[model samples]
Target chain A: MSVTILYKEQPPFPVMATPDGDDLWLTLDDLRSATGWEIRPEGVCREGQCVPIPEGREREFVRESPPRFNLAALARWLEQPVLHDDVHGVWFFGEAARVRRETLRSLQAPDFRLPDLEGRMHSLANYRGKKIFLVSWASW
Target chain B: MWQGLYDELKDRSFVVLAVALDSGGVASAGQWILAAKPTYPCLIDERHVVAELYSMVNVPSAVWIDEAGRIVRPTEVAGASDAFRTQMDRKTKQVSAEGIADRQRTRTAYLNALRDWTAKGAESPFAVSRDEVRRRSSGPSDEHVFAAAHFRLGEYLYTQGHREAALPYFSEARRLHPASWSYRRQTWELEEPGKAGGPDFWSAVDALGDRSYYPPVTL
Candidate 1:
C-alpha cells in the first residue's frame, strides 16, 4: 500500500507499507524513508540513539517471513505519538515525550523555521542575541 | 498594534516576530499582513507548528525570548482584553465606555511590561527566573500530542481536496484537546469565513462560567 507519512513540520512524504489493523508495517527501506530509522542487528537505530527491541518481543515489532517492520509498535515503544487517518491513508508522528520534557526543563525557546509572505525562510535561531516578542495571531 | 511596538523598540535590538497561524496560508493572512505594512519578520505557519511547539492554545499568545534564546516568559495570552466579550453586544459588536476603557488599560499595561523587559533585558522585574519559566511552560501530554498529529493529518487531507474526509479528523482533534482554540477556530474558519466567532464560540465562552477565556498575564 502507498501511504503518506507526516513527520514533524516537514512536508508529508509517501511510502509503501502493509497496514494490519492499526499497525503500519513497512519494509526496512520504506521504514527508513518514512521515519529516519533502520532496524539493525543491534536494534532499531537512528543517528544519535539506538533502541533495542525488548527480549522475546521481537515478533511484535518485526516479521522475518515477509521482512517487515512495525512503525506503529516502534513509535509506541519510543513514546512518540502517532495518529492514523485511515480514510486518507496518512500516518502522522509527533515528537517523543522525552524531547519535549527536555525542552521544558531547559527553558530554551523551541526553535522553528517558517516562510514569510515572499517565501523567504526565517529561523528562530537567527534571532539570537536579541529580545524577541514572538506572538501568534490569525486572520479568522 | 504590533507594528507600532516593533517600531518603538527595534533600535534596542528587539524584534517582534509575528506569526500567523492560518491553514489558509498566504491567501487568508496576506491581506492583514499587508495592511499592517510591517517591517518585522512576519511569518505564516500553515501547520500550526509554533503553537504545538510552545504548547500555546489560543491566538495572540506569546513567549518572550532573551538574548541567549532562553524563554524569559512562557506562552500566555498576549494583549487581548475580555471586555470585548463581556461588554459588547453579540450581534451589534457595540462596546460600552467601560469596555473600551478596560481594554485600553490592559493593553497598555502589557505593552509597558514588554517595554520594560526590552529595555532592561534579564534584569527587568518582568523577566522571570529559569525555574519559574520552566514551571510556567507546559509540555504536551499524550492526548495533546496525538491531537496535534490528527490535526496535521486533517490539514493535509483538507489541502489535498478531501474536505469532507478531513472533518472527522478535525473533530477528533477537538475532542482530544478541547483547550486548543487554534484547532477549533482554524477548522471553523476554513469551513466558513466568519464562523469562528459565531454561535459556537459564544456558547463555548458562556460555558466557561467563572473560568477566563484569556489566561490572565501575571506581570
Candidate 2:
C-alpha cells in the first residue's frame, strides 16, 4: 500500500509501504524517502545522529524476505510522536521530545519557511539581523 | 493596527511578521491581508505548522525574537483584551464605554512594550532573560505532542477530500489539547462555515467564567 508521511512542518509526501497490523514497513530506499533516516551497518543514521539497532531485537525492525524497515518501531525508540489514520493511509510525525527540549534550552526562535500571498517564499531565518515581533492570527 | 505599528518601527530595524493560522488557506485569510495592505511580510500557515512549532495554543499569540534570533519572550496572547469579551453587551455585541477604554489601555501597553523592545533590544525591561524565556516556553506535553500529530493528519485527510474521516482526528486533537483554540477553531471552521465564531464560541467563552480568553500580557 501507499502511505502519506507528514514529517514535522514539511510538506507531506507519499511512499510505498507494507502494512502489518498497526505498523508500516518499508524498503531501505522507501524508509529514507519517508524519513531522512537510512539503515547503515552502524544502525539508522541521519545527519549527526546514528542510533544502533537493539541487539537480538533486529527482527522487530527488519524483515528479510523483501527487506523492510519498521518505521513505527524506530519512531518509538526516538520518542517521536506518530499519529496514523488507518482509513486514509496518512501518518503524522511530530518532533521528538529531546529535539523540542533542545530548542527550548537554546531559547532561539524556531525557524520556518512559508509562502506569502503572492507565493513568495520567506524564512524566519532571513530576518535574523532584526528585532521580530512574530505574531499569529486567523481569519476565523 | 499592526500595520501602523510596523510603520512606526520598520525604520528602526523592527519587522512584524504576521502569520495567519487558517486551514482554509489563502481563500480565507487573503481577504484580510489584502484589506490590511501590510508592508511587512504576512505569511499564510495553512497547516498550522507555526502553532505546532511554537506551542501556540491560540491565535493572536506572539513571540519576541531578538536581533541575534534569540527568543526574548515565548508564545503568549498578543492583542485582544478580556474587556472585548467581558464588557460587551451580549445581545448587541457592542463594547461598553468602560470596556472600550480598558481595551485601548491594554493594547497601548502592549504596543508601548513592543516599542521599548524595538528601541532598547536586550536592555529593555520588557525583554525577558534567556532563563525566563526557557521557563516560559511551553514544551509540549505528551498529550500536546499527540494532539499536534492528530491535527496534522486531520488536516491532510480533510484536504484530501476525506472530510468525514477527518472529523475523528480533529476531535481527538481538541480533546487532547483543549487549551489550543487554534486546533478547535480550525477544525470548527473547516467542519462548517462560520462555526468558529458562532454561538459555540460564545458558549466556550461563557464556560471559561473566571478564566481568561487570552492570558494577560506580562509586560
Candidate 3:
C-alpha cells in the first residue's frame, strides 16, 4: 500500500510504500524524488558527484503495492545520516559525507548551471581562470 | 562602489560578478539593477544555487576566487563600501540603536578589509592562509549542511508556488542555522512583513538577542 512520506527536503506526500515488518520502505522512484539524487548504474548521483550503492539496492528496495524503501539505508548508501518519524512517516537526510569531504579538499567553488534573463544559461565555468566575486543578494 | 572597483580592477584581470538571489528572479531585483545601471555582468539566482553552494548567510555575502579557481576567501559579509552603512541606516529605520551600531562597525570593517585585500592581493593581512580558509569553511558542522539542503528545498517549493507547504522546510533551516539571515529574512518577509515596512529583520534580531544577529566578520 501507499503511505505518507514527509521529507525534510520535500513536501509531505503519499508515495508507494510497503510495510516490511516494522520498517517502512519507499519505492525507488519516491526515494529519488524525495532527495535530488538520482539512481544510476554508478549508484546514486547528484549534480557533480556519485557514490556507489550497495549491491542489490536497486532490486532490494523494489517491490510491493508501490514498493517500500529503507530511507535510512539509502542515507547510509549515500554516506548521509537520516531520521525517520515512524508514526508520521517522515525522513530527514543529512549531507553526504563523501561529497562534503571531496568539496573540502578541492576548495573549488561548487559548479552550478543557472539561467540569466532571456533564458540564456550561465555557469561558474564560464568565468573560470578569473578572479570572481560571487555575491549573493535577495530583493527582500 | 562595486562598479567603480570593477572598472579599476578590470585591467588587473578582476571581475565582480554580482548575483541576485531573489526568488522572484529578475522581477525582484529589477529596480535596483535599473537604478544602479551596473556595467558588470549581473546575474540572477532564482533558486539560490550560489547561496547553497557557498554558504551565504546574508545578502552581500561574497566569495573571492583567485585566478587558479581556488577560493581566496570563503563566503563572508562584503559591503560595496563603508557608505553601505549610511544606506542601511536609512533603509532600516526600525532597527534598535545598538543593532545599527553593530551593523556600521561590521560594514566598515568588511569594506576596509576588502579594499586592503584588493589592493594588496595575497600580501594583504586580510587574505587568509589556505589552511585557515579550510578551517573557516570546513564541513561547517553537519547541522549546517542539512540546513542548507532544507533551505534549498524550501526555495524550490516557494518558487513552485507552494508557499504554505514550503514553510516547514524554511523553519527547519532557520532552526538548524539560526545565524542565517538569508533563510530567515526570506521566509519572514513572506509570512509577515512588518506593518511599517520591510521584513521583520529587527524582530528576528530581537528574538536572537540584540548583538547576535550577525556573525563576527573574519578581518
DockQ score of the complex predicted as candidate 2: 0.84
Candidate 2 has a TM-score of 0.96
What are the clashing pairs of model 3?
A25-A68, A25-A69, A26-A68, A26-A69
| lDDT (tens digit, per residue) of candidate 1 on B142-216 | 888888887888899999999998888888889999999999889887777788999988898899888888878
Candidate with maximal DockQ: 2
Q: Largest lDDT belongs to which candidate?
A: 1
Off by over 4 Å in 2: none
Docking class of 1: high
- Model 3 chain A: worst 10 consecutive residues (lDDT sum): A83-92
| 2 or 3, greater by DockQ | 2
Q: How good is chain A of candidate 2, measured by TM-score?
A: 0.90
Q: Which model, 1 or 3, shows the larger lDDT?
A: 1
Which model is ahead, 2 or 3, in terms of TM-score?
A: 2
True contacts kept of each: 0.91, 0.88, 0.63
Between candidates 1 and 3, name the one with more favorable DockQ. 1
DockQ of each: 0.81, 0.84, 0.41
Candidate 1: C-alpha RMSD to true structure equals: 1.7
* TM-scores (chain A) of the candidates: 0.86, 0.90, 0.51
